[model samples]
Target chain A: MTTPAGTWNWLTDPAHWAGEDGIAHRLLEHVVLTAVCLAVACLIALPVALVLGHLGRGGALAVNISNVGRAVPTFAVLVLLLLTPVGRWGEGPTVVALVLFALPPLLTNAYVGVREVDRDTVRAARGTGMSGRQVLLQVELPLALPMILTGVRTAAVQLVATATIAALAGGGGLGRIITAGFNLASTPQVVAGAVLVAALALLVEGVFAAAERLGPPWTRGGAR
Target chain B: MPPDDCLARNEWICGAYLSTRRRILLDATLQHVRITVLAVLIGLLLAVPLALLARRLRPAAGPVLAGTTILYTIPSLAMFSLLLPLYGLSESLVVAGLALYSLTLLVRNILTGLRGVPEETRQAALGLGYGPLRLLLTVELPLALPAAMAGLRVATVSAVSLVTLGAVVGHGGLGNLIYAGMNTYFKAQVLTASVLCVVIAVAADLILLAVQRLITPWTRTERA
Candidate 1:
C-alpha cells in the first residue's frame, strides 16, 4: 500500500469524524484519561514528597523506593489490573495503572526540588518567625515550584503516550485507532493513528516547556 | 502447553507455572536482555556525537535537544505502529524506536556532563598544550563520566520497560508471554512475565551502578 497517500486520505476523510470512533472523540478520550491519571498521581505523590522534603527526612529513601516502579512496564500493570477483580471496573483499572506509572517522576522531582532548596534560606525564613508549616508552604514550596511543575510535565507527556494502552484493555483512547488499523491490516490507518498520538505528545511537551520558561526565575535554574 | 492442564487443575500458582515453562521463560528473558542492551548501546553511540556537537556549538543545542525531546515523547505503541508500514512487524523497528526514544536522555546528560567540567580545568588543559580533541578525551569526557553513567542507567531501565511494547509488534520477549496470558486469563503467566520484567530492569540498573562506581572510584569517599 502507498501509505503516504493512503494515510493522507484517511486523515482527510470526513467519514472518520462523525461518531464515537472519530478522531476528535478519540483525542478527547485520550486527553481526558491523561488528565485524570495525572491529577490522581499528583494528588497521591505530591503531598507525601513535599512533606518528606520539608521535614528533611526520608526524601532520598522515598525517591529511590518509588524509582523502583520505573522498571515495571505499564502494559504489565494494566494487564495485571485486568486479571484482578479490578478488571470489572473498566476505566478504573486503566486509571490506576496510569497513576502507578506516573508516580516516580512526580515524587522524585518534588522531593529533590524541596531537598535542594538553599538551607540558609530555610533557616533565615525560620529566623524571621516563619512557623514550620509556613516555612514549608511559603519558602520551600515556592522554591520547589519549577521542579514540581517539571515532574508534572514529565508525567503528562508520559501519560499521553502510555494512556494508549487503555485501549488494549477495552477502554478508549488514540490507541484504539492503531489497534483497529492492525485488525483491518490497514497500514495507512495505523500510520494516521500513530501520527495523531505523536503530535499530541509533542504538543504536551511544548506547552509544558513554555510553562517552564514562564516559571519564577529562581526555581527555573534549579529545576533539573 | 501445560497451561490448559493447569487451568483444568485450578491450581495456577506462580511456582507451578514456573516449573512447567522453564525453557520458554529462559528464552524470553534472554531476548529481553539482548534487545535492551542493543538499543541502549545504539542510543549511546548516536547520542555522544550529537551531544558533543551541541556542547561545541551553543546555538545548535536548543534545536538538537528539542528534536530529541519531541522524539522521546512519542508513545511506544505509536512509534512501533509508525514503523510498521516500513518494517512490517520486525524487531528492527522496535529496536530503532527504542534507540530513538533514548536520545533525549543520553544527549542531555552527556551535554550536561561535558558542560559541567570546571571552566578553569578546560583553560588549564589548553594552557598545558592539549589539543581540542585531547582536551575533550582526556579532561572533559572523563569528568563527564558520572553524568553519562547516570544517563545510561536511566536509558537502559526505560528501554527495558519499553521493549515490552515490542511484543505488540510480534517480537518475542517477556511481553509476549504477558500478552498471551492476558488473552487466556492466566494469572500465573502474567505475574511471572511482569515480575521478570521488573527483575531484569532492577538488575540492569544495579549492574550499571556498579560499573559506574568501578569506573569513578574518586567520586566515592572513605567511610569513617
Candidate 2:
C-alpha cells in the first residue's frame, strides 16, 4: 500500500491541478455542490421561517423538527438517498443531502430572530398603517438579518466540511486526495489534504465573522 | 383466490420486505448506538479536564479552544481517511475521530457555563473565605453544570449522528445498513435505516431533556 515518500509532491504540481481531470476540476465540483446546497436550503428555509414567525405559530414544532434534522448525520442521509431510485450515485444525491443538512439551522435561526424582535416595534409599524407584509419586510427582516446571517455562517462552514464526504459516493472533492492517501498509506498526502480542508474552513469562518461585524451593533452581539 | 392475488403470487412481498429490512435495521441500530455511546463517553472524559484547564488559565484558553473548533470543522470522512494511514480501518480510528469532533462543543459549553456564573456569587464565596479550588468546586462548578450539560446533550446528539459515517470504513452501524442498501439499491433497507436513525435521535434528545430537568430543577422552574 505504500506510495513514493514524496507522494504529496503532486499537490503543488501545476499540471496536477490545471488540466481537465485534475484537482482543480474536483475542487470546482466541490465548491459548486456546496454553494448550490446552501442557496437552495436558504431559499426554502427563509420563507418557512418568515411565515412561522409572522403567524406566531408552529415555532416550537419547526425548531424541534429542525433539531432532529440537524441531529441526523449528513452522510447517513446521502447514503440513504443513494439507495433510492431517485438518487444517482453522484453530485445530485450528495447536493440534495447537504441541502437537507443545512436547512434546520437556517430555518431555526430565521424563525427565532424574527420572533425575538421587540413587540413595540411591530406595534409601531402596524400603527403607522403598514400592511402585514410591509411591516415584516420593513422591520422584522432587518432586525432578523444578523441572526439569520449567523445561522448561514454556521451552515456554510458545516456544508463545506461535510461536502468532502461526497467522495465516498464517487462525488469527488478534496476528500478524494485524503482517501487516495489512505489507500496508498501516504502520510504526507493525508496531511496535505487535511491541512487544505482545515484552511478552507478557517477562511470561511473568518469571512463570515467579518460579514457579521459589518452589520448593525444590535445584531452583531445578539444572544446566541 | 382473487384475480389480483393470483397475478401477484400467493407470497406476501410486503411482509418479506418488512422482515428483512427490520433485521438489518435492528442490527445496524445496535451498532450505531454502541459506537455513539462509546465515543461520547470517551469525549466527556477528555473534555471535562480540558474545560477545567481552560477556565483556570484564561490567556492560553482561546488558542487551545480554537484548535479544537478547527478540528471539529474538519470533514469527518476526511479525518477518518487521514487517520486510516496511521490506524487503518479499525474501531479505534472511528471512535478517536468522533471524540475529537465532540471536543469543541463540549469544551466551549463548559467554559461558557463557568463564565456565565454571576460575579456576585463568586464575590460572596471569596468573602466567605473560600479558596480558588473550593470556590470552583462548591459554587462555580455547581452553577455551571446545567449549561455544561446542555453542551453535553448537543455533543451526544451530534456524536450519534456522525458515528453513522463509520460505515464507509466497513464498521457496522445503522449507516452500514444505509450504505449496504445504497450499494445494492435496496430502497426498503435504506428507508428503514433512515427512519430508525431519526427515531433514535428523537428518543435520545428526550432522554437528555429529562436528565436536564432532573439536574437543573431551577432551570425547569424558570421555564415554567
lDDT of 2 by residue, B1-224 (tens): 55453213423133455664566656778888887778788888888889888888888698878788778878887677666666778888888788887777888888889889999999999999999989988899889988888888888888888877787677748788777767766666666677777788778878988988887788878878
**Residues B17-68, candidate 1, lDDT per residue (tens digit)?**
7887899999999989888988888999999999999998989999999888
Tell me the spans in candidate 2 whose CA falls farther than 4 Å from its real position.
A1-8, A88-90, A182-187, A214-219, B1-27, B221-224
* lDDT tens readout by residue for model 1, A163-217: 9888777789999999899888889999999999999998998888777678657
List-wise, what DockQ does each model earn? 0.80, 0.53
- Would you estimate the TM-scores of all the predictions? 0.93, 0.87
C-alpha displacement of A79 in model 2, angstroms? 2.6
* Backbone clash count, each prediction separately: 0, 0
Residue pairs with backbone atoms closer than 3 Å in model 1 (clashes): none
DockQ of candidate model 1: 0.80
